[model samples]
Target: MKYVRKLPATDRQLSNQLIENGWKKIKEPRNFSLAVLFSLPFSYLLGSIILWLAYLLKPTLFEFLISDVLSISFSIDFKMLLYILFVFVYMLIHELIHAVFIPNFTKSKKIFFGLNGLFGFVFTTEPIKKERFLVISIMPFFLLSLVPVFLLNLLGFLNWYTLGLCLINAVGSCVDFLNMFLIAFQVKSGHTIINNGFETYYYPMQNIT
Candidate 1:
């Protein structure tokens, strides 16, 4: 999907607007190597912990459910695959929702896709004020992340793998939760004034236009 952000009179104008609201436009990293470096092992470790908890909670039920419903032979490896795939798809859609919503801002926007370890983000380069940003950041979690968990739980009652997948989906929203909280806090810091004193910072170089 594509998103566009209309640029203001000039980059300086946009940058000034951002700075007034507490946003400092920094140069894009030559590589997100450090981010990846921290995220890779982190993903594996977190994924492992989640899988272990699932195994402990319902070893027999989990094994049986995967074997019977998913029609996969019972094995630790297969269950691990199911866990990773479930989490990855859930998170992917969450980020995609952010991308789709950006077009409302401007005709120019930029999006970058890469793995931050096993996790990823779709960021926009456009400078958005705080009020609009609340919608952009919170919408995905509400519409894509949480709503899917409710639906997936219904399916989970019918299939064990689906239940496992739903669990992963719920947990995967932690990233969204953190993003929302950080943005909200930044908005509250009285930086970028929007309607009612809400402020949102912009990342120009990372914008997807």
Candidate 2:
């Protein structure tokens, strides 16, 4: 029971869709810009918090890792071009993470990978459990960002390659974080969440009428 709440739609359009599917939309749809901007501060805070926890868990190891990341010194000849390319590639990886989790969580082959409004996403209309949904949402940050950084430290390789990847992926994950927040705050355990690849809907087990 990590989170429990009624489901919500982002707007009237999604509201109608959810209603058509026999699910209740309990909240308004969030604007694209607002959703992206709202996650910036929280992402930084969460990044800091994770660092602090890492330090507390292993002070010496954390210090070494920090030093390694900080010691990475190099200049890119085509920084802007590289940044742009990396973003597209990393975003693909991010969406792929979501897509990969679909089969595990849903019995449907209706998964989709595409852009919606101002963002790119992997969407599905399949019903998924709360815990599994969270895992699907958070997997990219863990595999693409966290795991790479951890491995960099463990392998005694200190460079900007993995560090940059982590940072880029972290920033790119703002939307996922927002969705995770909404789901965690609004949805209860044991309930199924349905997504039409854009908005998510939920119905209470005891009150589906």
Candidate 3:
């Protein structure tokens, strides 16, 4: 719930404590670029699916995009505004969504968020259960990406502007979605995740108890 100029470095003390308590570190890609590169396939696949489903839900969106987006008649300034706003707003919301889902986020006051270049990140040393951590990871996509598309479609207002935002959010969430899958597959049901800077480690809850 606190904003830091920079995310706290991996808490060696916490890491040692967790290890002493029998926590096992989760192996993650060594760097951000590598992680993003590893997740790009998932990103592309998810992006394609979202675009396809949106097309099915409202075909005219695709029609407008193809016919107008490429045409000189489309207003570049307006589209640019929406793009910029979506990036700015979505960046904050995306990190906030992660922060909100962490158990007793405000009470803990350990959750820290900040921007790294163009990307926003949230991290905490709090040990969150596997299921809970997964929720924190993926909530942003559900709230900001798919929900917007459906809500717009429901209101009969689906258009290229909103559709593009949804797609951008979905693509931007590639790393999170991949992390969800990675943790689910690797970490056991009873495990909990502890963050160390951008790194993550997990261990069985019983070990701490």
Candidate 4:
């Protein structure tokens, strides 16, 4: 994969060409305004689920979040500095998890990671199958958000860094969660999904025209 300083603009021409090639567009927020509107529910629901399961597995995390993270007095120390740095690094790691699952990423050289405005994202022109794409969309949620919390809770260490990773990534991965649901409900199995910049498309594996 590659990295760019700034992601390129949405390639409408490429989107148009994909349409001409008979690939169909998948559902996506038409604009950032609608994105915000639609993403809130997903973020809330996913965050709730993560927190619910987190405390269920180990009640200490919930207690700590409520009693410590919420009530702790303001301070600037090593852990605080680490948390600050972690917040920035989390975005990169999140996208990297996405890039790793992207089919043929290691070989394709089409995948890229970078900032687009305020968000760090991974982009690729490769066509990915529905089953595989579903994994790609949601893997980061598990690996970055849930796994850290679950593992730490299981091991009996509760710290702000892991919790911060857990909470922030839950909200940060709102779009991935949304896309997973959209693809699961809207697209048929055995099909492939691709995108032209921000415009996504899906086509049957047997009939990629």
CA lDDT scores, all candidates in order: 0.49, 0.65, 0.80, 0.79
Model 4, span 50-156: residue lDDT tens: 77776677675456555644655789999888877888788888898899888777877778888877679888878788888888888888998888877887787
Give the number of the best model, judged by TM-score: 3
Compute the lDDT for candidate 2: 0.65
Model 4: lDDT to the true structure: 0.79
lDDT of 1 by residue, 1-209 (tens): 24223211234565566678555532221234443343344345434554554455446655655564565465668768877786688777776776667654334434444455566566555445455556666675466434444564445542455545544544554444444555565444323322111222443233322
List runs of model 2 lying over 4 Å from the truth: 1-17, 20-22, 26-29, 49-84, 104-109, 115-119, 205-209
Candidate 3 wrongly placed segments (more than 4 Å):
64-79, 206-209
Cα miss at 97, model 1 (Å)? 1.5
Clashes per candidate (backbone, < 3 Å): 20, 5, 0, 0
Cα TM-score of candidate 1: 0.48
lDDT of 2 by residue, 3-80 (tens): 112222235676686788678543424555677687887678657654553454346644655474566455767976
Higher-ranked by TM-score: 1 or 4: 4
Write the residue-wise lDDT of candidate 3 on 98-177 in tens digits. Answer: 88888778887777888877778887877788888888888888888888888989998788777877788889889997
Which candidate leads in lDDT? Answer: 3
Ranking of all candidate structures by their lDDT, best first: 3, 4, 2, 1
